[model samples]
Target: MLQEVAGIRIPDTQLAKDAADILREHGDNLLWNHSNRVFLFGAVNVRKTKQHYDLELLYVSALFHDLGLTKKFNSPDLRFEVDGANAARSFLQQYQIPDESIRLVWDAIALHTTPGVAEHKEPEVALLFSGVGLDVMGDGFEQFPADYREEIIKAFPRNNFKRDIIPAFYEGFKHKPETTFGNMKEDIVKHFRPNYKNKNFCDCILHSPWTE
Candidate 1:
């Protein structure tokens, strides 16, 4: 609902508006609101760090970061992250966006859950991941002023995010359980599918065919 927060204004370009509409059409309200918060929180961090980034790129990445979780975008065999990334790539290509810019948004969405890696990428990528972390896990939460945090939430109310987000996550990847392997998403699978057994990396190595 907020067009501007902490000196950062939502990109009002037609492309950004279209992107928001696409997310709204395909994603539920939780994701719709969460995506906006991601951009706002990411923007705030950009200012805090005194770093320059393409607002449009960051905005698109934030908006589509959870898109893979939506019913329309979820895939049978791909990681939800990849599904989201591919959706963003296709949308950007439609506007004749350059490959480089598309790649940045794609990577930001795909690597957002990968923790150690995303934090070191391009500013857009790193900041998007940071924003998601702050929103979901409260990572680095203490750094943001309480009033600013209040403003962000007031703009996009969490509305039981603590409990709702779990089901939101589970439903996204539940059908593609194998895709969650070797990632934090495996935990989600295990939580919901009590009998779920994660594929062991060590087991894979031991079973792998080799002459050695």
Candidate 2:
């Protein structure tokens, strides 16, 4: 009973279903819906450009990309992105998926939050990054058809996303502020935890062991 939205077929393989079920169990309604939308949006991009891609990998990557933000998957020391990426790597390993495919999923999840870089990687990585950007920030929003956008939203309502997603980001990694260094996520930490201090690149350079 796989459904198509905007002419993109949802992957129905066992691997896809298993990944979806795991995410559904661990993630809240907002996250679950958002993840599903990411997969569809990524697939739609590939279809729109008539580019060849591995749909199942895209689906799995999208499903697992934000998983590190969940309580069950959050780790104490690693970046949330790496946490999610490692989770995908371990899951794919169990199925004996090829190392190269696992690597793509890992990179896609790890770099999805990074601008200017993910877009230059393999198609799956780039598409996942764009898909997330489109859903969260409306990047490339105009390229999608109006009716298709309406349909996608209907299937996965984004109720109060603008107001709620910030809190979601804060709660996900507030406990691991150190991991936010070198990324925009530090802004989230700074906003909510006012007393929190972010690492400064210039400060590190000036205070290094070398004295001029």
List runs of model 2 lying over 4 Å from the truth: none
lDDT of 1 at 132: 96
TM-score of each: 0.97, 0.95
lDDT of each: 0.91, 0.88
Q: Which candidate leads the pack in TM-score?
A: 1
**Pairing residues by index, what is the TM-score of model 1?**
0.97
Quote the lDDT for 34 in model 1: 89
Tens digits of lDDT, candidate 1, 143-203: 9878878888988889999899989999998888999888898988888888998678998
lDDT of 2 by residue, 106-180 (tens): 999999999999999999999999899999999989997778788888887899888888889888898889999
Model 1 C-alpha lDDT versus the unseen true structure? 0.91
Q: Model 2, 68: alpha-carbon shift in Å? A: 0.2
